[model samples]
Target: METMRVIDKIRQLIPPLSPGYHKGQAGRVCVIGGSDEYTGAPYFSSFSALKLGADMAFVVCQPTAAVAIKSYTPGIN
Candidate 1:
């Protein structure tokens, strides 16, 4: 059995970006995980989504985790 090339698969999965696109229009993602001692997970997940061109990314977590996430980036709110 033959499989598609990695580049081809990537091209199919990720859409191309248009010029002058506004925020929250490309894609929106929400990561629901985090705790006082586990704040890193949501941070990484939200950041990865943003890096992938997601227009908006949010992380829902406990109050303590929320503070840590915000410390990492004000944009995560």
Candidate 2:
């Protein structure tokens, strides 16, 4: 299956919360794919996870990538 189809299926599987539900009760995800030469990958992954409704997301990367990713945005760290 394609990526979009997979994402759609996941969305379908996730049930909506009740009216009184609070934050951080849904899901948390960490994007762990960055290296000295690849900081944007983690940024994109983390942002995409957030866009997909994850309550929290984090980017784990090598030192060089961490520096660049931090420079990209404080939120990325």
Candidate 3:
């Protein structure tokens, strides 16, 4: 694919920034997964959303995994 064309197509998919919009109006995402045997899955999903410009990322994981996830970053709530 033509790089510029791909870039333009992606840009077109993004909503225009407007003062009328409030926080999280552009994007909000949640990733829910994790367990004693899979503690990193939820964190990875939540982090991917944040890296992609989501206004908020939430991880809904088992209580046992919460501490590890929280310690990994302050970005996930």
- Output the number of the TM-score-best candidate: 1
Model 1 agreement with the true structure over 1-77: per-residue lDDT tens digits: 13558768878888788888888878999999999999998899989998989988988899878888899876445
lDDT of 2 at 44: 82
Look at candidate 1 and give me any clashing residue pairs: none
Cα deviation of 13 in candidate 2 (Å)? 0.7
Sorted on lDDT, highest at the top, how do the candidates line up?
A: 1, 3, 2
TM-score of the candidate numbered 2?
A: 0.68
Q: Is candidate 1 or candidate 2 better by TM-score?
A: 1
lDDT, candidate 1, at 33? 96
Model 2 score (lDDT): 0.78
Worst 10 residues of 2 by lDDT: 17-26
Which stretch of 10 consecutive residues in model 1 shows the poorest summed lDDT? Answer: 1-10
- Candidate 1 lDDT (Cα, 0 to 1): 0.85
lDDT of each: 0.85, 0.78, 0.80
- On TM-score, who's better, 2 or 3? 3
Sum up the clashes in candidate 3: 0
